[model samples]
Target: MRVRPFAVALMTAALTPATLMSCKPSSPPADGAQPPAADAGPSSTQTDTAFAALSKRFLDEGLALNPVSATQIGEHRHDSEIDDLSEAGRNKAIAWNKAMLAELGKLDIQALSRENQVDALIMRNNLEGSLWDSETMQSWAWDPQVYSGLAGGAIYNLMAREFAPMPERLKSATARMEKLPALLAQARENLDPARVPKTHAETVAKQNKGVLSLIDTFITPNAGQLTGEDRKRMDAAIETTRKAVEEHQQWLDGTLVPNAKGEFRIGAERYDQKLKFSLNSSLSRAEIKQRAEAELKRVREEMYKVAQTVLKDKPGAPELPDAPTPDQQQKAIEAALELAYADKPGREEVVDFAKHTLDVATKFTHEKDLVTVPDDPVKIILMPEFQRGVSVAYCDSPGPLDKGLDTYYAISPIPEDWTDTQVYSFLREYNKRLIHVLTIHEAMPGHYLEGVHSSKFPSTLRAVLRSGVFAEGWAVYTERMMADAGYMDNDPLFRLMQLKFYARAVANAILDQGLHVDNWTKEQAMDLMVKQTFQQEREAEGKWVRAQLSSGQLATYFVGAQEHFDTRKAWEAKLGDKFDLKQYHDKVLSYGAPPVRFVRQLMLQEPIQ
Candidate 1:
């Protein structure tokens, strides 16, 4: 599955901060904080300096406001703190966002450097989006996942990485654990069951206990590392948090799940607004639908051609026609895909296979000289229990602030209760060839590679608020790029799998809007994924649950890829004979994963908006 790097970060209304600092800037001056008397109109250098200063100030204050996120970002000063989820706490965050945005607006973006202009836009969108989420969308009152992610991340972030010593991280985890009860209480108090979606309530109920597992896996083992009073506090904190989680789980089942009467769909009006902020793209819902539908038709045609090549002489191969009907096309493609699915991994071998594929993909990228491959280590691991029931896989890159840490390419393990038939369905979907494509998307020259490059960019603000559009889009874009460059010696089965994978991204764009805005039925969604996109039964069902659980996110893969393709085409056009694929890839990534349009503008030297 494609990675959702900003999944929780975007959904939750917090703007995560940079590393530690005590001093913070004062409130924004009136008139949007105009320049000093000595300078009526600030020079280019002055505007740049002012914006940099403001950006630093926001990061400092933001870390204090949201310490869980701070810990996740490798900011250790706030490691012992957690964001207050109460009404007053949210208002305080909202007010701070407003103040930072006001100070941001005072700067002359035109006069500032192109890079800083992108930072300003990112900061503005995050601030505005946070306010809208709190004031208008009000997800806090309805979305239990928002709070659950926060609770789980508070413990997970501190222990998942070793940015600090184990003993130090354990102390921080204990502090956060001591705060878990109040966070859970605030979640129970703030969430109105009548407004919570049933799917969300059920999922969070399942996930709430997963925190206990995180405590056990990451915390319990290391408790012995601490001595004397520290060990005592750790033991006591763990017991306290375990009780709190158990009680919270009871409420989730007995109260929230029973009373969850809310609609999962946000409706068209809200989806349109959220898409603008979520994507940060000029493309409208109509435009995305138009392009995705067109790509759907085009990719299916390409897949049918591949089917003809693969099934050319097989005894029971479906008839392949030059101008096939829709039914004929579906059969031909399915016949070809089945051949690829025949080489399936044992359920127990999925993680080992994924690790092997990562090595293969990394080797291929290095051999191809595709882009500058980072030496940053990526580890393939099982998806944590708390974060399951969403996507099957993800790329968990370390926080940009946390240098030299390993990036995780986490694949969800096969569920124990799944029938043999269900497991077969899953293994077939994530077959040997497709697993290579998946590894390329989630690891090599994908999210992991892009993240390494993004962190190296000079601006802290840009790294803090890196663009999901660019990150996801670049990952999706690399799938096709790798296939074109003859990954696996241009194996047609691998190419077929790559197209099928790309088709899912195309299908996601259509699926996202259809489910959230157009009121698509389960049957309609199934037809799109299964019949049209050729997804396995297991994959389609999981996506149905994920679609309801998320909004506007499903569109990112398609939209981001489209923008990336456009950026590359523009670069090629501008550079003409001088264009180099490796150079283009390196240059684009160096921009810290801004919106594709901004990357294009920065590359082509166009006017920054």
Candidate 2:
């Protein structure tokens, strides 16, 4: 959803499964669970003050424990340091989490303001989730991508942004670079080759070397910006770090990959737990699958109707009967989509086309008076090499702490080694209409706009713990919202692409559970992506890899969108004719990026726990 620093991605990749058990703190309710009435407990301003202080302390200490995360969140105080990945370092973090959980337990939730109650609950979930990840999941012993993200992000964070002057940032970069080898050494020490999933190992094997490329891209060019001793030290650090990265690459290939025999699938129990934490929703695995399956059918039926419009009377068109059989429905949808695919950009023109789409989507959002469009600068750039091989594009907004910096709408370039066939497949998948849908999801009224609104809230704590479900959900929701509102002049092709994209999100929910919990084979996954969702071969293939590399993430779009849709419907029901679209949107985003459930509760004056 958001991938500014690959570090967050890596951290989440490793520590994805989280279970919120009873903590020392007065057991904060799990996400979406009802809390005590606001006026039930002793009313006191003192509890609010205490909890606020505790919240700040937790963030400060927690950031100190993971310097890379601190940097990504725009806390530059730890810019020169890398995370301590050693066993002792991890134990120290666990202890810190326990201590904080204990402190949080002493607070009175009902006594605090409603806003503070939400923050308190989020803090508790965060603390308990960290413990569950470290103590229960023990991902550190298995996941190599976790360490890779940290190892690369140490320098990437400093160089990616201009939060500080060039010389200052370079000095920080040098300090982190100097410390990187030991961090990599710690990763090597911590990872168990037998426990490392082969896919993860292979992915990191390719990515580990990308750290050097990062230095070349971000650090080497700026080395001349320094002088004398500082420049000399940076040069020395760069050389040492390069050797370290090379050695790490050797280890990853020669040792890790060959010995990586661990299962990529986290299995049913772990998948369920991770779904709970990652989604922070009431929806269970079964509920998600059921809803996703139903949506898949309903959306396809709608697409078939659109197909009839696009394919009506065309030569070689599939039969579009009013009540078509399954085979006919599939044929009709595919034939109509071929028309959309015919209008795709060339391999070299994807980024340029995306830029144009952003402008057009922005103008539409403003003209239609959709949610207020922020003036925050957004740049369309190539996806960084270390972060490639996953999803096609990600919105990398500035860290909430970093005020008015640029939001990078990063699209991965078509790989050079790929044949013309592969490139064409990729282009057809990301055709002109789909690109407009993507622009709506990632930049104009999606992540970039939501991020701007989220940062406007004064609470740093909320910004630091923004929910992926809410963010990703809003993006997917917008694609349909824009299409239904007649974006692109009520173009049926655009609507079809939008529905197809939504279907992919629905399929993502099913695919994730299928692969992780249901023992789905590659063939089964391909069938779902290519045949059912109407994805291009290249897109399906990449998603298969993405599904294995990360669990619970692919489903966030569908789960989040469902919640957003429900929340909007609830408000519409309550307000009746008084409900205004722009106002509802502005207010929904105003609460920072909390889970949609919490946002709903807050908006509806329900008890937030």
Candidate 3:
């Protein structure tokens, strides 16, 4: 029921079916005692109906408990309610998950349709995973961001979309704002200082303060429409919320910062569990690490070749040996990337440039018959202040349940306080062609297009239980797809940048495992990003912060992209000349953003795993 963030870049068993046979009661004199007759169980239609009902019931119950999630996915029935972060609230959530899981356990998997079977698995995984998060991982006790994010999003969700009138949304915002202090108080009570990680405490301190900015930017403007009494109440609520945020920020800075003593790493065991839940893939952690390491090596070599191509005519370029030394390879790669970096947008022009690239990418997708572009409009906006520090940009898709709302493609502006070197490094890393790649991922054929398709999917449970792997994997896959399909004139420079992005994706998995599981130092992670992946210093430093703040998530890009590629390869091999890109993309996306393996099952009409 967590309101999962719609940020850009963002498990298995076997069962046997028993054959049922009618048995006549044998006489006592028969060869053996008569066996009891087997029950054939429910018909497929009956099981499907039961499952359909159960899924609807689960969705309704879940949304009722987690109102913030309801608002996130465009379910307005509970839009005005705030989640209770108190111990009782947590217990209620745990109990709900247990109950739903028990209910799911009663359903017969084999009797359900293939689609229903997938939904059943999705429901079971979501419930089990949520329980694990609450009981085992216990982010509420250690991660201050959990509370601050909820507090901020409580208002942000209502105000960000136009699911209701301005007056009504503002009213809901006021009601949520009035509850802000209690939410923060519960946060303080729930977060144990001894278990609070330093990075989390620090980030939340900043984010708690930023919540006030969200209110100012999103809520205050709409308050003018209220009548006298409502206006008075709204103003008072806003003031109270601002004071509460400020007090929480003060506490985070003065108390939590000094006392936070927890380890950032969740350790190998927890990582494995969370990764399984997050990915829902068959690949084990060791296998993922192995594949990532292999991909990292292969991507680096590809970059080296592209570097050789770019620097072949440059002064002091290293000689192209059959086997260049590591130092030579590094030097040539840096020199070639310099050419791409030279064409970066100025600070003021970043968002505009992204807008321009989005238009171009959209045109290309349409002209080339890539996936069907949704008629739903997409907007490019600056990242709200509260959402910064996590990543540079994300695609904020409207709730799947909310039709005709604008999907925001938000780009974070460079901070005003950053040093010139930091700013330059950031801009260089997100240079012109790279910006185009970002557009392709966050907009066009990436999150925006896929998200639109996701909204049209028939199942509510599938929509709510979206697969991070498929969402991110599809976005990552589209980058390579566009490059291969002659985007940007099929220019090698663009292709080089695409490979560089892919390398970043590969290193993300490496960094996630390295830092959390292997206890890698920042220096080690930075080396992997800056030297091996060719990321900028500023980017690497930010990635280090992000790596500590999150785990099991960074690996999704590489792992998911590989799953997507593997699926495509199998499909192509199976279909041969019958294979069609548009058909394949449409078919895969039509199932909503389930894990690629499930998509594979559905696409090929294979047995459900």
lDDT of 3 by residue, 403-476 (tens): 65666788877777777887787788888899899889887898778777765556666666677788888889
- The parts of candidate 3 lying over 4 Å away from their true place are 1-42, 375-377, 380-393, 411-422
Where is model 1 more than 4 Å wrong at Cα? 1-42, 347-352, 375-394, 409-419
Worst 10 residues of 2 by lDDT: 19-28
User: What C-alpha lDDT values do all the predictions have?
Assistant: 0.80, 0.80, 0.76
On TM-score, the candidate that comes out on top is 2
The lDDT of model 1 is 0.80
Q: Candidate 2, residues 1-609: lDDT per residue as tens digits?
A: 553321121233245322110001111122212233456454556676677677668767777787887887776888888888687888888888888889989887767777778777877777777777787777788888888888777877788878889999999999998998998898899889998889999999988987888888898877789999999999999899989998998998899999999999999998887777677886899999999999999999999999999899899898989999999999999999999999978777776778889889988899999898775457778987656644567787666656556768898766767788877777788889988898899877888788777655555566667777888888899998888777986689999999999999999999999999999999999999999999877778889998998889888889999999999999999999999999999999887777789899999999885
Give the per-residue lDDT digits (tens) of candidate 1, residues 80-147. Answer: 98878787888887888778778887877777766777777777777787778878888888999878
Model 2, runs deviating above 4 Å = 4-43, 375-394, 410-419
RMSD of each: 5.1, 5.1, 9.5
Q: List the residue pairs that clash in candidate 3.
A: none
Q: Considering TM-score, where higher is better, how would the candidates rank from best to worst?
A: 2, 1, 3
TM-scores of the candidates in the order shown: 0.91, 0.92, 0.90
